[model samples]
Target: MLQFKLVLLGDSSVGKSSIVHRFVKDSFDELRESTIGAAFLSQTIKIKAEEQEEDVVIKFEIWDTAGQERYKSLAPMYYRNANAALVVYDLTQKDSLVKARSWVEELKNKVGDEDLVIFLVGNKLDLCEGEEDLRAVDTSEAKAYAEEQNLLFTEVSAKTGQGVKEVFRSIGEKLYASKKDEILAKKNRELGNRVNNSVDINAQRPSTNDTTTCCS
Candidate 1:
């Protein structure tokens, strides 16, 4: 089983905790309490590899951080070794998207891992359902930014459990693929070393059939 540290970041009341709750518990609360410092949760998912017929078990160690300004300083601590991050924004709030972009920038700078998968998520789809005017943030705009920043982007409603499962599933698939690549690279390196060592040993071995006659 492979374990990955994942973190959620966004502005206050952007539904970061709600999304995490929905993904983990498969339920939602209308009056979900705000997260304090950070909430810890874990979920194990089984994903099938695309190329091979094998099931990969991925356990996500989720850190749902507080979105308030006071907790902004502590964000780095939670995401220090995070393999992936979900930068969420509320669909009803335009400023929330701005905050989400900032969080993405911070993660890129602080995490500094090129392989770290960052997702730009728009939450609160329930609020905008059937009321396009209620959406303050444009989907095309968010998606354009995500594309420019090379991020995974999606819109989900935690309340109705819409697009919630796909978010985690995508992350699992990407993480599993990365792990597989790493393992293959390591094995290749080990094989190369063994071949080099064998060559060295053969070169050092003395010739068994020395045919020089000393006294003819």
Candidate 2:
């Protein structure tokens, strides 16, 4: 399996932990407490391959980081070598989206965009159902910003599990597609090294063809 580190970033109470729990455990907690520093979780997802017989397995080593200002300094440590990131925001708060954008900028500045996959996620879709006035971040506006920044974008409801699976599924598929060759090449190299280092114990034993008696 190919493994990658994924990080979650956003303001406090934007449902970053809820998103992780929803995706990894298929459960939700209404009163989930704020993350202290960071939490680590891992989940493996398979991406169907049209050109291969076996599905591509991607294991995401997820780091769910705290969003409080005090923990902001620790975010860099969590996101340093992350392969992908989800910058989440609440749809009910426009300021949350602003904070999400700052997180995105920080990621691009610190991590660089070359090999990092980023998603701008607007959470709490359930809150806006029927009560459209509750939505402060316009879908079109967020989508536009996502496009401008070259990020994958989606809105999800962690409580209701709407669009939750799709978020991680898309990440798995995209990462597999982008890193398949590199991952395969790395595996091949490791296999080759193992083969070359293998010792032939049978070859080291004294040959039976040697007829000379040892007791002579």
Candidate 1, residue 7: CA error in Å?
A: 0.1
Each model's lDDT comes to 0.86, 0.88
Residue-level lDDT tens digits of model 2 in 91-173: 99989999999999999999965879999999999999884558988999999999999999999999999998899999888
Residue-level error in angstroms, candidate 1, position 63: 0.1
Query: How much is 136 displaced in model 1, in angstroms?
Result: 0.4
Cα misplacement distance, residue 178 of candidate 1 (Å): 1.9
Candidate 2 stretches with Cα past 4 Å from truth are 186-216
Per-residue lDDT of model 1, residues 1-216, tens digit only: 568889999999999999999999998999988899999999988888766567767778899999999988888999898899999999999999999989988888888788899989999998887755589998999999999999999999999999988999999888777778775565466668678765433223322222223554
Q: Each model's TM-score, in the order given?
A: 0.84, 0.85
